[model samples]
Target: MMKPVTAQDLQTAGFVPERRRGPAVSVAQATVDAIQTMIRTGHLRPGESLPPQRNLARDLSVSRATLREALSILATIGEITAKPSGRGFVCADPGEKPATPSWRFAARYSLREVYQFRHVVESYAAQLAAIGHTDPELAELRECLQTFRRAALAGDISLYAQADFDFHHLIMRICRNKLLVDMHQTFASILLESQRLPTERRGNLMHAVQEHESILEAIAIRDPEGASYYMRKHISMAGSRAGLPLSELP
Candidate 1:
């Protein structure tokens, strides 16, 4: 038997078995949420221009890749019509309105639920990502980590957040599955709202940074099972710390 690796296995490997996903918000979540808020509030009409990707990413506290993934997802879910090299994503016709109870339920829902959902979906995506990830994909993942480490050391919250979001965004790209990525993008806002600050709850940022390094090493080895295990542990640990239930994440 491949030795049954417990969370403790992470330690001897020089990594804590923290939840891999950490119910963190993806870049798509942040982007979609802003767009949805604008649409319902009449701030963004059917044909309004979205700010440029770089500017929007800065404003939304996400990365360009995350925003792009969100756009792709929104387009897939019929939220916005895309324009090539256009300034922003456009609003589509509002879909069928749900019942009042449904709306209320959604409105009251926390973004943590969204992150939880991603934990499930992206956990699976991580498995796929490990299988399909290429050299370029690995490089991108490394670059994101480097940016994240640099930002963390410098105590730059915005850049840290951006880089943090990008690391997972690149992992999703490794899945060779657009549908899963799009689904995540479609509800970007909920995720943004849910995973506001995983790192905030951490007692030590440098400790967390060290854990992230282990995750990247597993992915570089293309160890799908290992990557999936680490990701699940990371997400689950964060949820536990946040006092969240996986089933209750919505």
Candidate 2:
């Protein structure tokens, strides 16, 4: 029988408990990394139930909400599975591969179709934003990019998703085109989901962050063509990360 891993085991494995004051996403990511380290070092073995959430959270010096978010991310990536009784999570066998997430909107729109639409509409929005964005709008976009980078570095997919949405949505608004903004607003949920799909599939996000930086640099220089080109490239790469081949996109 696999022994249950206690919080003391984690502490002894160098999982230092610290009170951090910042975005909960970063804190949650620290929790995720600590748990992963414990598992990697054999303190938490496969099929072992984790310490109860209350005790674990207290030991980690993180809020319960932050701990829950970390656990949820671990579950999503197949590092752990929730117990049948909804009590706590258990470590997955290291040999077991994580399952790929299925597209939930396949009945209405194909993934290729969605990426194509994003490539067309969002690239144009970037072009327009490059020409029309004001100083304050550029500053806001820069801030959004920074947030996205931070979330990506911390491996906080949920926060990264929001930052990704805010970055593109800001571009739509900066374009000052009511039709474009309306279209983005109408399809906000779907767009956000599309953004999340790639992150869930790929472990590293710094490449996408670099792409965003290129796109933003173009926009900051008021180069509409460059902005449009970089946005197209970023969307293409994002699609490829989500299992859609660049050759398959139109």
Judged by lDDT, which candidate is best? Answer: 2
Question: What is the TM-score of candidate 1?
Answer: 0.51
Residues 1-250, candidate 1, lDDT per residue (tens digit)? 1123233332333321122324564435545555565556565566665666776555555567876766654554445765656446656656532211112225656546555676777677778777777898888888888888898798876676567566666777778788877866676655543333544432233434565676677777878787877776556544433334333433
Each prediction's TM-score versus the true structure:
0.51, 0.61
Clashes of each: 17, 0
Residues 1-250, model 2: lDDT tens digits: 4345566766665554655444433576578778888888887789999888897787778789989867865765567877889788889887774355577888888888989999999999999999998999999999999999999999999999899999999999998899999999998888888888877662457767888999999999999999999999788767756666424544
Error of 2 at 242 (Å): 1.3
lDDT value for model 2: 0.81
